[model samples]
Target: MKNDFEDKMADIMLGEAVTALLDEDVAISWAALTDRLRSAIEIETDEDRIRAGLRAIEEVRREMHVRNGEKTEGKRVAALTEQKLH
Candidate 1:
């Protein structure tokens, strides 16, 4: 028997996972945007600005990868569910 806090945490985790999975297109767009940002960053003359942009791009890439993983997991889950239902 799960406690209320545990149940709430599980729900929150599940919601986050599902939301991440649903934003597959957004993740792909972010990847493209990061690529563009990298190109812009390359031509930047200001060292500080270049470093900041790189940091931001890395953060966004990390998130995009996470979303991509979630999307893959969601697809696998869907496939398994479909197989079970048939």
Candidate 2:
């Protein structure tokens, strides 16, 4: 009974959580995360809901980090810049 927007939002939120838990590169796939979120929402248990809510919070934090451009790598910077920092 969820609308398209709600479903999409849930998937996005779930993706963020998995990304945070597994690290940005190793997180669960979007398809898998979405399925997991949907399953969590469908469950009647309070514990499961709480767990899923925690995951959702982690995901939001990760997304915020990316949005703020905090993540960086020396690998992408030129050798000269890297050397300057060292």
Could you say which candidate leads in lDDT? Answer: 1
Clashing pairs in 1: none
In candidate 1, position 7 carries an lDDT of 48
TM-score of candidate 2 to 2 decimals: 0.32
29-61 per-residue lDDT for model 2 (tens digits): 544555555555566366545455545655655
Candidate 1 CA-lDDT value: 0.62
In candidate 2 the C-alpha lDDT for residue 33 amounts to: 56
Best-fitting candidate, scored by TM-score = 1
Alpha-carbon shift of residue 25 in model 1 (angstroms): 18
> Taking the tens digit of each residue's C-alpha lDDT, what string does model 1 give over 1-86?
43454445434433443455456544535755566557656887876556555666666668888999999999999999999999
lDDT of 2 at 23: 67
- Relative to the unseen true structure, what is the C-alpha lDDT of residue 3 in candidate 2, on a scale of 0 to 100? 47
